[model samples]
Target: METQDSHVNSDETKDPGAATYGNFINYYTFNPPENRLGLIPEALLENLGLDSGDEPVLMLDVGCNSGDLSVALYKHLLGKNASGSKLHLLGFDLDQDLILRAEASNPFPRNIQFIPLDITDDAESQICLSSYLEKHKRSRFHLCTCFAVTMWVHLNHGDTGFKSLLARLASLSDYLLLEAQPWKCYRSAARRLRKLGRSDFDHFKALEIRGDMAAHAGQHLEKHCSMELMQSFGNTSWDRSLLLFRRR
Candidate 1:
């Protein structure tokens, strides 16, 4: 419900780009205004096959750092469909501290729940997400948004790891909104990995020159998972793209 600026002191936090590694709160506080992020809920709602009056829409936010964007999106959806559509939002992150902060700060606790989850881990993701879906009587997630998480998986697990992560994400959700970072930003990710003393840092470089990184990744997703890109939004400042995909 509250804007990210209202929740944290942006002036006090250092620029996210300058930090070698930082927590979710640091990133949320200092990151530039991402107006495109707010467009996700509307996009999902428009494409959701269910009628507005039929059933509650289920949405998932993967790697939902500090829950700022998730909460804002929840409010936006509620505002658009006041009487007809009910939304149940679930936000997952690997950071327990961030989840705790999200719970503490959430204004609409009844409408949303934040859980510490590693969606890339097979057993953990299956057990946790399956249980939740079972409880809700849902077959698949109506919409899933993953922002700036691919690079982390790639840097840690390499190309194979990233694709596996994408496959899992695609399997869980009917529609996916992904933010893909360009190859130029690979150096920064490598630096972050190095700061953490990672021995596998060279993996990122190997994956860098695939050519028009976002398109290359999208092609891979299309071929492997049958996901087709619906629309794309460019963020020139960051050399990143926000892509919306539908499972084919």
Candidate 2:
């Protein structure tokens, strides 16, 4: 599938810090039926065993864009259990405008809320996020899923970012779902683009030198064979397996 070639400066447009809000606006307007946000929320709720009547779980849709994922989760809960149980779904993004738009849409259930968070710095970000989890200990999250967000870490911090993100997700979830584009796609695209003189591959390599090499470059770089490893994750050995890890 051909993706839009964004002319905006990657440094500005792809800023991990900017994810606090809606970054997709830079690419597309907010419209329905075509967006994939609904799929994630439904899948997450099913995976987490969250249903109606129970106290809402503390769901964190990291890299939530325009709150579609959050809406999807709520919709799933509403559909499964019309008992009107409250849901405490918090979405974090870098852009305030996106947050406002999400609020304006008001797609959340009465119990849901959205917040702005900068995930670029793990140490500080975790301290804050963990605090919320602590206060809401009664509502242990059944699920924590980061969709299309790992690319930011892999692009900026390379494997280090990936590991840090994994550690955090492990702390907050009973089940987790993480997805990423194959590194080779980025590498191949960069090579092809450079050959055609469209853009310098150096920009892509700066984020990741050997792997996808499209996003992360400055920090130490290496390929971890993640796409291969994550493919065999779940008990049944499904390709895109949902890793069910109990809290240790």
Candidate 3:
């Protein structure tokens, strides 16, 4: 669970979390790095057989708010790396403030990097991500993790936008670790907006893709994105499933 001090500090500035509102500025305060780390299997990345052939193994953390989880995951993988392959992790968030904080607090400056990016902007995201890949002489990241980030895309961008996110990540990654927010979470998010006296998310009610959100994403990845489910790391404390997929 999140540290009491962190949670208290976050609550001091917490937003209503509406779609129109920016993301929870200090998200890891409520959903701590340890809680997120507990659900992941040991040596998960190493087990994926990621052999970069002398180059450092590259990983991407999507929606990497505040970089706590990204930092934790990098250390976890680095410590247990039996093959002694150098590891480089890149974490990005749409929130420039969050990314700035991530960069400021980052411990492993050489191995981990944080940048601000809005993944839904196809051209911008593609160009930025492609540039990173090109710099490292890598076609795609060895692993990509998108935890508890789908709802915002779905609620704000509609069904089509949701699918597009999954498809794009799959294209950029050899393996994907996704934690899509469930349907009830969507209702709760919508309700929170209502409670805050904010207008409803425009794309919420019209979304054709509803119910079992993780499954819907999985199906789309396999059927439309040429990816296959590899395994499940089980559910997080928030009752969100952590699923792993690989490009076919």
Off by over 4 Å in 1: 1-22, 38-44, 47-51, 80-85, 192-202, 205-209
Q: lDDT, candidate 2, residue 182?
A: 48
- The lowest-lDDT stretch of 10 consecutive residues in candidate 2 is 217-226
Off by over 4 Å in 3: 1-22, 80-85
What lDDT is reached at residue 47 by model 3? 77
lDDT of 1 at 7: 36
Q: For residues 67-167, could you state the per-residue lDDT of candidate 3 as single tens digits? A: 98898888766665523347888898877777788999988888788988888889998999999999899999989999877888888889889998998
lDDT (tens digit, per residue) of candidate 1 on 1-248? 11122233342244342222224366665553346554444545755564366676788988787888788777665665543346788998877777888899987776688998776678998999988888889878888887777766675567887888889878888888788666655666455445545453547567643457678668877999889998775553565788888889
Ranking by TM-score: 3, 1, 2
Query: Between 1 and 3, whose TM-score is larger?
Result: 3
- Tens-digit lDDT track for model 2 on 1-248? 00122232354243322221114554333234224433343454544456545555666767665676567656665675533455567677666666666677765446666666667666676777777777777434566656556545554455566656666665566555554444654554444444444544333455533543222311111132222122223321111223233443
Two-way lDDT contest, 2 vs 3, winner: 3
* Deviation (Å) of 115 in candidate 3: 0.8
Instruction: Name the lDDT value of residue 235 in candidate 1.
Output: 59
- Scored by TM-score, the top model is 3
